[model samples]
Target: MYEIVAGIDKSEDRGRAIAESITEMPLDHGEVRVTLLHDFQDNPEGASVDQVASVRHARKILEEVGIEVVLEESSGEPADAILRLADEQDAEMIVVAGRKRTPTGKVLFGSVTQSVILGTDRPVLVCSGDEN
Candidate 1:
């Protein structure tokens, strides 16, 4: 069975959609392990804690599909956290939602998707938020 680790942000819809897509893929008699990861950005004003709701919702969805989930919280860069978790889990594939950014934003902050792709030897599946 191949372990599938999904990197989730605060977007509940995107997280659920990615989980569903992974569930639908043909496993060829293998099992799937779903992991929900969140990198909580530090907010001195306590605004970032609101991501708890999204993480909880994601856990519920995966559980409904009979997929065991490993939920973790990290205080670091999102890309770094995801890569570290994938490695720790010995995940064969890493899935994350693809988000579009303005050219200026892309230039200032390089794409996490690109970074993950370049950094890891394992296959990276990027699900476009617009895709079904």
Candidate 2:
């Protein structure tokens, strides 16, 4: 039962690339239980239209590789929400994507990806958003 937790932003611009990078990672022939999680709720009662679109896009990518997935949405701190889900699922890996930020900017306003990496002992696979 190999499980993975992936955190993503459902932005119109770069969400597809992030999802593609995660599913296209080199695999050693094991089926994955992928949880495609998006924490894009200010009031997390149900899936927003954009969140639904993000999940739909992500599912197609993972399914192409024969990996089954479930979509989940959460409200609250994005980084904390991701960690909680990973811990609950006992995930083997955590995948997150982010753009390159300046040191000053990072220090002033810490990033969700950075926070997740530092907060957990699990292996974090960071997919940079600058990829073409």
Candidate 3:
């Protein structure tokens, strides 16, 4: 029953899987609040309506499993948004999706997963496509 916050994004499958996996974990006490945060870049056209709707729908599914969800939409960098939300929530654990990259690619692009791990004080759980 630990207070866990999950950072979700455009990847629906991976996000849902991460939420589901967190739900399955054994916690001792507090309730788990799964937050789905999407950072929309500032643009003339504004954010995609369909993307917002999709995240809302995903929140509904997670809510069904007894996970209290807070859906957030903001304009900023992904890593910054995630870290800010995690701090605001006082999350015991921060869960996010891990990107698969070759050694060269990881070195060049710099990994978001790595960034989160280094930037946050909370334990970061990365759910990848191949993770069991």
Candidate 4:
């Protein structure tokens, strides 16, 4: 089975994009497995990955099509957590969503998506979060 680690954030649109991309891929129902990951930098409320709304959204879409999905949670740096988890899981691919950002904005904010893409040797699937 092909294993994929999808690092989903709080954005509903981005989460949907990731799920849609996976659905559109030409894979058999049971041939692939997706692990939905949510890296929480700060969770005072103490939430699980399955409690995340975006994760729940993605899970629904993937499960509807008979794709095996696992929910995971981690703390600390998002990119680091995602990559480390992917390595531990021996995932075949990593999936992440990126928003359209101005060059200046990106430089100032620093992108977790960019970090994940560059940090991994495994294939990365980037889904556009921009609706337009």
Task: Compare the candidates by lDDT and give the number of the best one.
Answer: 4
Encode model 2's per-residue lDDT on 4-61: one tens digit a residue: 8888776523456656776677764247787878886565466563446656776777
The residue-by-residue lDDT of candidate 3 on 1-132, one tens digit each, is 456666666666767667667766775223767777777765467765235654665676767777777777667677888888889878788888887789999899877678889998889888874434
Ten residues in sequence with the least summed lDDT for candidate 4: 123-132
Evaluated against the true structure, the overall lDDT of model 2 is 0.77
How do the residues 48-123 of candidate 1 rate in per-residue lDDT, one tens digit apiece?
4335666677677767767777777777788898899889989999988878788888789877777788889989
TM-score of decoy 1? 0.81
Q: Which stretches of candidate 3 lie over 4 Å from their true place?
A: 28-30, 42-44, 48-50, 130-132
Assess candidate 2 and give its TM-score to the true structure: 0.82
For candidate 3, the 10 contiguous residues with the lowest summed lDDT are 48-57
Question: Can you rank all candidates by lDDT, best first?
Answer: 4, 2, 1, 3
Candidate 2, backbone clash total = 0
Residue-level error in angstroms, candidate 2, position 55: 2.8
Candidate 3: give the clashing pairs. 1-27, 1-30
Model 4 per-residue lDDT tens digits across residues 1-117: 989999999888999999999989888968999999998989999989888899999999999999999999899899998899999999999999998889999899988889998
Superior candidate under TM-score, 3 versus 4: 4
RMSD of each: 3.1, 2.7, 3.2, 1.1
Q: How many angstroms is residue 90 displaced in model 2 relative to the true structure, after the best TM-score fit?
A: 0.3
